[model samples]
Target: METLRNEIQQLKAARTVNVKKDVQALRATHAGMEAKVLKGEKDLNTLRNEVAQSAEKAEKALETGALVLSVLSTPGGQKRKMNEIS
Candidate 1:
């Protein structure tokens, strides 16, 4: 009976060691993945900013084109009418 108890205790100790190692490994992996995701978010934000800037430039270019067109379409400095049917 004493021998059986000792065997059980040893088995439990081995299992505890294995569980601890597994938990450590999982934590390390989770931390690495977290770092990678943060980096990706930073890159995504940079890309989004670049796209926003490009859109702003495009809007400005279109506004300039409209201004030039209005100047050309006017007569004697009259305000140009919009082509909309409303």
Candidate 2:
């Protein structure tokens, strides 16, 4: 009975060591995943800023185009003046 108890204790100790290693590996994996998530969030914010800037530039360009069109469409504007001079 004593020998059996010693064998059981040895098995239990081995299992404990394996569990500890597994826990350490899991913690490492969790840390790596967290880092990746943070980096992804940073990248997303950068892209969003770039998109906002691009949209603002596009809006400005559209406003400039509308102003040009309105000026050209008005009576006695540049187009009518050019036609009269021609």
lDDT to native, each model: 0.89, 0.95
What lDDT tens digits, residue by residue, belong to model 1 across residues 1-86? 99999999999999999999999999999999999999999999999999999999999999999997887677833333443323
Per residue, candidate 2 scores C-alpha lDDT tens digits across 9-73 of 99999999999999999999999999999999999999999999999999999999999788788
Model 2: lDDT equals: 0.95
Question: What TM-score, over all chains together, does every model reach?
Answer: 0.74, 0.85
Candidate 1 TM-score, true structure as reference:
0.74
Clashes of each: 0, 0
Residue 49 Cα positional deviation in candidate 2, in Å, after optimal superposition: 0.4
Candidate 2: deviation at residue 17, Å? 0.7
C-alpha RMSD between model 2 and the true structure: 2.9
TM-score of 2: 0.85
